[model samples]
Target: MTRDDLIAMLREQTPACGPARNALIAGADFVVWDGLVPANRHAGVFRTRMRRSLKRGRTVDGLANSVDILRRAGEEPLRTGSIDAVDRSFWFMIFLNSTATAVVACFGGRRPITMESAGL
Candidate 1:
């Protein structure tokens, strides 16, 4: 899908609460990451690494809500899209599988109070 389409879709999603809400921010770039080295899984892999790294905020509230948005658009299998992080605080991603399922990941910040999640 086009960048505008992706942004629009993400905009309608359940945004993060508090100041860092509105996951879709101005000047952010939306891209299809299905072509890089690890293919569509690039963001996911990094998420896994982050989960294993300094912080793993999967169980925390407000973090894992983005995946619900991704799952809603899971009809397109094996597709992936990512939103460039704004303010170096957070980035969002959506990955679709062959089973017509999708997962969204949104994370930001560095060390200490980092936010990470892959909502189902």
Candidate 2:
């Protein structure tokens, strides 16, 4: 989908996934992309390998819950978005499954050294 369309879709989502949806979609200093590209280096989503997964147990932690949620999607397409926000920048990921579910998650943090001098 087009970048604007993708962002618009994300803006219309509810709290099905992350608790920080509103802030994530608010006044983004930089536009988020489906994947990291040269144009915007600070925020993007991409398919990633979960290094460590917390298996099922009697009790579940936040990480476990997130894992289990994604697990239910099985081998279905899943993309994780990692944001390294500098100041008012923003980032988030939209996960879609076969059951027509959408899980949105986001985070913000200091921009990396690579983006220090790079223009938005």
Leading candidate by TM-score:
1
Q: Looking at candidate 1, what is the lDDT of residue 95?
A: 44
The CA lDDT at 66 in model 2 is: 42
Residues 32-51, model 1: lDDT tens digits = 65542322334445535545
> Which pairs clash in model 2?
none
Off by over 4 Å in 2: 1-18, 29-62, 83-94, 97-101, 104-120
lDDT of each: 0.42, 0.34
Per-model TM against the reference: 0.41, 0.35
lDDT (tens digit, per residue) of candidate 2 on 1-120: 333343444432333223234444443333333432221111121112122212222221133334444444444544444322234343333443222233333332232334554764
Q: Give each prediction's root-mean-square deviation over alpha carbons.
A: 8.7, 10.0
